[model samples]
Target chain A: MIAALLESFAAAARGLPLTLAIWGAGVATGLALGFVIGAVRFFAPAALSWPLAAVVEAVRGVPFLVQCFLLYFGGPFIGIDLTPIVAGWVALSVYGAAYFSEVFRAGFMAVPPGHLEAARMLGIPRNQAVLRIMLPMMALAVLPSLANLAVILIKETAILSIITVPELTFRVQGVGSATFAFAETTLVLALVYWALVEATAVASRHAERRIARALAA
Target chain B: MSAPILSVRALERRVGDVEILRRIDLDVMPGEAIGVIGPSGSGKSSLLRCIAGLDEVSGGAVMVEGRQTRPGDGAVGMVFQQFNLWPHLTARENVALALKLVRRMPAADAAAKADAALARVGLGALGGRKPAALSGGQQQRVAIARTLAMEPRVLLFDEPTAALDPELTTEVLDVIRDLAAAGTTMLVVSHEMGFIARLSTRVVFLDHGVVVQAAPPAALFGAQAEPRVRSFLQTYLDRVAWARDA
Candidate 1:
């Protein structure tokens, strides 16, 4: 069982690159979309904010698996063809964006209204005020939430295996099916996921410290 | 006299159904310090906000040097009651922001000017410190320095020392006196009667959104004044005396 576990770990290790591919692409795309949507919802007039809020709520209301299946299997029915990897990216990005937008919105709200007004009173243009004052303040306020979202996204890449994206779970499941070492394979998968989360947390801590030091200057 | 450097004409401010300020008209001339004083909820701050262009006036206009302009037009600088120093920035950076943005000064020159501004306010050695690290008075001084760096034609202060205790209030008032003596044009909204008496060339007494009287400190603070104004001043003085004893 020990030898089988070691072999399964090696097989799963090969899938790391693909797993990382989905997580990286998904998080980056989601963050960009999230910032835009979040800013619109938080800062835009009610005429625009209400519709964006509805979209965010709708996305967050559904389960990730249902959303994934809809994109991957539902695509062909709509005359849209997408590879498993492409579908995985789309589902992960959309799911992550719904959650991330809320995180960013809360971050913007945390900044005191007085600070923004003071910036404007000092003749800092609106766009520059948002960029130089609002964004940096929001970033620090939202750092921990952002780090947590990254961890959630990392773990969520496992869902991509359902679409046969050949990520860690898909490959590990393949090894288990062939060798009948279900328990051993499961243990190895758990360890890999744990290590990934730990690494993310460590990296987040380092980033936070660096940001603090930079702001101190 | 030559046209006032800053002018507020028929300024009215309404928030929802409530009128925060109405029919407020005042003019601040060069080398003059106008003190605006009134009891709580009397719309003193709102009037100042209108002049600074911080709040939209439902009616009327604010003219800076004969030009209709908005708040932050590089013509008027304001020091807030809370100081409102950007918490993440050092004292120097706070002072440098408008210089870089409005004056378009190079980074090096802005830093040097920021240093000189800080020095002007007796904060030269504390420029590297953040607001959170400084005392309340020091933070307010930094806010004043930040405004001064803009080299505004008129400075507006909204209860500049309201948030401080007695000791800190003295420190901030001392800075204002220096500016007053230096002939900087200013419009100050303050609750501190002594500070207002010492620094103002003219004192505008406000009550219920109207300018009850605009006169020198001596004429207004003297025994003969409007009944409402006299009563308000008596209450303020009584409160101070009570606070000191308590």
Candidate 2:
């Protein structure tokens, strides 16, 4: 049993870097795309906003796992063949962006309209007002929600293994099949995810306190 | 004698089918302070907003210092009832932000000017605090300092003391009173009867979005006042007396 556990652990460790790579890339791209989506939905005119809204709703309504399959498998039929890793990354980023946009849009609405008016009255440039005043206010108002989405994105990366991406779940599953240590491998995998999520929460709390102190000072 | 520092010509503000203000004309000479008083929804705030170019006029013009003014024209500064300071920023940063962004001042220079402006409002030592950390009065004073640092051609106040307690209102009024004494051109929309009476060079009473009476404080508040103006003052006095008796 110890031998089986060690083998499972080794396999899981081998897949760790790839899992983290996909998650980090997904988050980086998702955040950039999501910010644009949210701003357009909130501030753009109806002609431009409606189409983006439809796309966001369609992406959000679909299950992320199905999106992974549709992109990885169905792409070749449409002359857009993507490798498993590329397919998984794209699917995950788009999925995460859809949800993250909602969080940002809500945060935008939560900020006081008076703040922007004050900025404009003071002669601050429009772009500066949005960047320096509006975005920071929205981010501060919705920090916890953004952090929560980030944690959720990390876990969602596990689903990427279904498309044959060699991530933690894929490696652990291989170990389970080879050594028949399904229970041991799966248990360790659960613990790994739990640790990552807990770390994210603690780091979020630390960042929040630092920001509060900066604001007060 | 000097050209009017600010001019509003036939200002009209219509929201959908409702005409909130119509054909309002006003002028403020250099060193003159105008007090605007009226009942709620009589377009008192709208007039100030129009002059500051913060709100669009349906059919009118706002010219400050001989140029047509628009938002971000840097022609006017406004202090709001809520003292709309960015809650995340310190008082000094609040005062310096526009200077850095709009005036394109060096950060260090802007900081120095901000500190000086804060000192002018008697908040010299409290510039490091955020709005949340200060009293309602201090926050408004910081707001005044922020606007003063910009040195706009005209200053606009829309119910600057309405959000404060009586004690807190006194501190904000003191700052405005000083500004008036220094001959700053200003248009104040206020309910503080005593402050407006004492500080305004001329008082403009608005009703139903038009100027009902415009005169010096002595005439506007004296026994020989406009009947509409007298009734308005009477209503205010009645409320004060009722509150005291209660």
lDDT of 1 by residue, B149-189 (tens): 88888888999998999899998999999998999999999
For residues B1-246, could you state the per-residue lDDT of candidate 2 as single tens digits?
788889888999999998989899888999899999989999999888888777778998888888998876778999998898998889999999999998999999999999999999999999888888999999999999999999988999999999999999999999999998998999999999988999999999999998889999999989768999999999877887998999
For candidate 2, the TM-score is 0.93
Pairs with steric clashes in candidate 1 = none
| A-chain TM-score of every model | 0.95, 0.94
DockQ-based CAPRI category assigned to the predicted complex of candidate 2 = medium
List iRMS (one decimal) for every candidate: 1.8, 1.7
Q: What is the lDDT of residue A108 in candidate 1?
A: 92
Model 2, position A183, has a per-residue lDDT of 88
The residue-by-residue lDDT of candidate 2 on A11-119, one tens digit each, is: 8889888988998899888988988899999999999999989989999888888888889888899998988888888988899889888899999999888888899
Worst 10 residues of 1 chain B by lDDT: B220-229
